[model samples]
Target: MSYEFITLKQEGRVLTISLNRPPTNPLNGVFGQELFKAFSEAEQMEDITVVIITSALEKAFIAGADIKEMAAQDAAEAEQFSKLLQGANNILNRMKKIVIAAINGHALGGGCELALACDYRLMTSGKALIGLPEAGLGIIPGAGGTQRLPRLVGLSKALDILLRGRTMSPQEALAIGLVDKLIEPENFQAEVMQFAQELAAGAGKALGYIKAAVYEGIDFPLEQALAVERKYSAENSKTHDAKEGLTAFVEKRRPEFKNE
Candidate 1:
């Protein structure tokens, strides 16, 4: 599907969704709408196992929210915009695919929130910065940032970063678990594609179920969380991949997962 603010490229089992709005990709009503559509479509695609969200722009993953648009918004408009973005962000967390954020450049404000929604983040080295700088702008992170950041890192660290509106380089972000990996800026795209392809080779259904189990179970108590794991575990045992995997083990051979 064509999008006004984003571009979709599919290769084998991997789907790459690039934020295409030029300069700083500002998160706005149209951008949010397009993002929602793209991710929603990706979530339903049976062939796609891994989804990679990145930037086509040279120096941005996404800079932030649309400040000018926000400044002009009345209460109702602000609420609508917030809801739109919140919905888009939630789709990322809920999607079955193993979603990855290839942070090629700066990811700030809503950008950081978007990245946080992904299953993993790999940032390009050099000038790329990632963080929630909303507090400095006389606001707070209205998207998933406020909630997800603290969950990934601890509460104390998230508070310090959010309150100061701090931005960190790829290394610093990795040190604090903001980003999962860092790649050389020069080889960033190639590395990201290789990473995505590796993940895409895995059993799609099992990968998704594992993601669902962890995300769903994290909020529950131990027993309830174990039940969540058991639910997904039982569900995955019925998959084609599961059968192939077990049969392959019995045969002492590698499993050829078709993601069926």
Candidate 2:
């Protein structure tokens, strides 16, 4: 399959999708459209048990949205652009398979929102940074940034970062729970691939359910969250993978997961 602004490469159960417009992979209408199509396909691919969002270039994961494109657009055009981007962002958040952001370098504005949409984020050490600095650009983060960032970090922290419009180092981001893992710059790709493969090797169905439960339950009331967990647990229990997992445990052998 061909993608205009991205590259999709699959190795084993891990599907690596890299932003192709390098140096600074700036998001645009075309990139948003292609991302929606690419990630939607990834969500449906049973063989792709895990997806890693990364950049092909060594510099930055994504600098932010294309300022040139936005500068030329009118209010109506900008709204349409935001809608497309938000739609794709929602698809990423709701994807059943785990999505991990391999933050090789800077992630700002839309870039930060992209990482926030993922199930997990692993940032490269050294100069790499992640933050939503849209306020500096005279705009707010229109792509799930406002909501997700607050939930990931605390309300006060998220507000402070947004208000300051300052970028954060990888270490600072990790401390605030913005990124789950931090790795050396040289080991970034290898470590991300290994992590994704490890996730793929486990019970795939269970992973999906766990992701769903946490994401859905987070927004629900206490009782409602418990019900959501019960519902997902029941759904997961019906899968053949769940049965095989239990049986393999009893037999004291590694269980083969088919992502059923």
Candidate 3:
């Protein structure tokens, strides 16, 4: 399927969704619609085990939300726009497949929120900045940033970033646990694809279960979280891949998981 503001390419079991808006790649209503459409299409594809979200522009992964568009919105329109943003963001967390954010450049405001929604973030080293800067614009992150940021980086640091609307370098983001890995600019895309391909080669159902356990269990109490983990673990163990894995282990061979 084709998208107006995004492009989707699939290679083997991995799908790459690149934001196509030029120069800044600012998020808007159209962007949100197209993103959700791309994700919906991805969800329907049984072969796609991993999804990578990135930008086509070299200077900005996503500069921020489209201010010109927002400036024209009234209360009702703004509320509707927020709903669209939230729906788009929800795909990242609620999808059964893993999503990786390849932060090639600056990701601020809504851009940062988009990255935070992903399961893993691989950012390019150097001048690229990432953070929630909505406070500087007299608003707050309308997506999941306010909730997901603290979950990833802790309350104090999340508050510091949100309140100050601070954008930090890749190194600082890594130190704060915002990004999972940092890659050299020269080899960033190749490394990200390689890492994603490695994940794609694993047991897809098991990976999905792991993601479900972590995401769904996070908000629950300790005992409840363990119960959630146990549920997924038990369910995953019944899959064909799990049986193959055990058989391969006893036979002293690498298991070829079919993602069953």
Candidate 4:
């Protein structure tokens, strides 16, 4: 589970994964492979209830894909690389634990798509930018960008961004709902970790069920989605955390969820 291009740190119930390729953590074959390994490891950890994704560099979270590596790839190699990236992204999207993108700096192309895979995005204030800019490179986003971006920011806005290969400033990104929260640079890391830890402390089983209900339900018809939600709700109600939560509410005290 060791990673060469990324660093994993665990504290309490939260796991933080940092892209470690300095200068600009450009996505490459190795990066994608390492990311998949990291997520797989995280998924197996019993204590991990939340995951935060960020970068080790302050100047750029991830500038883009490794253009030099891309240029050296043949058609078959490029397709394989795309599939690898997509696989990594799918792991993030499908994780039961809550995933937050702590976007410290610019996140373009594949990096932006990576952020979109997370459940929440917290961006730093100031000049940091984020967007999918693959169109300018005579290519489209080969990862989940083309699908996830439109689902998140709506089809029209997503098209404008993709077609123009535009990058958005932090404030602009927030206005467009691409980012959930904008934190000042000085307190970015601390605040993001604090928020993640808060989420980790919640009822883990219920949180997982909520995530499943929303993620899986979105693709289903209204009736089917409601059924999906109802099923998870019924399952969650049988857990110890749900009982404790209800009892604590009546007792006027905080519930200590065991994630059982």
Candidate 5:
């Protein structure tokens, strides 16, 4: 299906979804819904082993939530707004495939939260800043920002950013674990796709299970976390990829994963 707010392209095992709105890729209700739909489609496609979320423009990954749209909302409308935003975010978070957020530029407010939802984030080295500044506008972050940010960067740092409504530089973000890696702006796309391809070549179901265990299990008690890890790992061991990997190890040869 054609999308108005985003562009979805499939290249081999990787699916690319680019924010098409220029300057500020504002996240509106419709945009969020469409993004969720796009992801839904990508998730069901067996050939799409990895998903790379990016921006079409060089100026910004996403400027922020669409403030104009927010201004037009009442309490009931606000509830609907939050649902749409959360819905898209939930899909991204629970996706089984590797989802990489490629921050080509600044990611502000909801944009920042969106990036936080990804399995991994690769940022472009430059002046790109990331933050949730909703508090500055007299509104708390309606997305998962409050919860995810603190979990990502610690409570103290997350509180400082939210309360101060300040943006963090790419280097600072890297230091706080907000981003996994940085790529020079000149080689950003290539670096991101290379990483995505690397992910695509791995065991798809195993990767998803590992990602789930790390992200979700981290929040549980130590014993509970270990249980979760074991459960997923045991399940992954049943896949054909796991069998091939074991066989290859025994043979002392490299394994070619089918992403099963």
Candidate 6:
């Protein structure tokens, strides 16, 4: 579907969703719906094995929610607005495809929450900042930030930033394990594409199963988690790629994965 705030681009098996409501891709209901549509379609497409989320502008990946929009909402409308945005970004977590958030610039408030939904986050090694700094605005982050941030960076760390509305530098974000990698500004897009291409070329079924194992079992008890993992593993073994991979290993040849 065509989107006013986003653009879809496909390269090989990698699908890149570029948000472009510059000078900062501020979150809004229409943007939320469009984002949900983009990811929902990506989730079902067999040709796309990996998805990259990035901003078209270099100034800000997403600065925050549109304050003017938020200011006009009552409590009920605010809740609905928050949910809309959450549902959109949450698709990144639910999709089996490897989801990478390429933070090209500032990612604060809702922007940070969106990034948190991705399987991994890579940031440009520029002056861009990232955080969940909604407290200073007299509102708390309502888009899965409270839950996901704590799970990602620990309760104390997440709380400290959330309560204080403090923003962190890219280097600081990497140190706190918020962002997985930092690519130099000059080669950020190239490096992000390269990483996505590498992941897209892997055994698709195995990749999906691995993601399923983690998300499905993360909150389960040890035995339950193991059972979840085993179930996915058994399912993965049934794929053609799995058989070819094992056979190639035994034959001492490179396994050619067709993403089966």
TM-score per candidate: 0.98, 0.97, 0.96, 0.97, 0.95, 0.98
Clashes of each: 0, 0, 0, 0, 0, 0
**For model 3, how big is the CA root-mean-square deviation?**
1.2
The residue pairs found clashing in candidate 6 are none
lDDT of 1 at 231: 98
The C-alpha RMSD of each candidate to the native structure, in angstroms, is: 0.8, 1.1, 1.2, 1.1, 1.4, 1.0
Candidate 4 regions exceeding 4 Å error are none
Query: Candidate 1: deviation at residue 140, Å?
Result: 0.7
Tell me the tens digit of each residue's lDDT in model 2 across 1-260: 68977888999888999988866989999889998999888988887778999999888998899999998999999999888888888887788889999999899999999899999999998887799988998988888888889998999999999888878998999899999988998888989999999999888888988998998898889999999999999999999899999999999998888988
User: Which candidate wins on TM-score?
Assistant: 1
* Per-residue lDDT of model 5, residues 1-260, tens digit only: 88987888888889999998766899888888888898888878887789999999877998798898899999998888888777788788777788999999889998998998888999998898988888889987877888888988889999999998878899989998999998999999998999999889888878888878887788799999999999999999999899999999999999988878
Q: Candidate 4's C-alpha lDDT?
A: 0.91
Candidate 1 lDDT tens digits, 1-260: 78898888999999999998888899888999999999999988999999999999999999998899899999899888878888988888888889999999899999999999999999998987899999898888887888999999999999999999999888899999999999998899999999999999999899999999999999999999999999999999999999999999999999999887
Reference-based lDDT, each prediction: 0.92, 0.89, 0.90, 0.91, 0.88, 0.91
Candidate 1 stretches greater than 4 Å from native: none
Tens digit of lDDT per residue, candidate 4, span 1-260?
67788889999999999888877998888888998899888877777889999999978988899999999999999999999988888888777889999999999999898899999999999998899888899989988999999999999999999999999999999998999999999999999999998998999989989998999999899999999999999999999999999999999999999878
Candidate 3: deviation at residue 125, Å? 1.0
> Deviation in angstroms for 75 in model 3?
1.8
Candidate 2 similarity to native, TM-score: 0.97
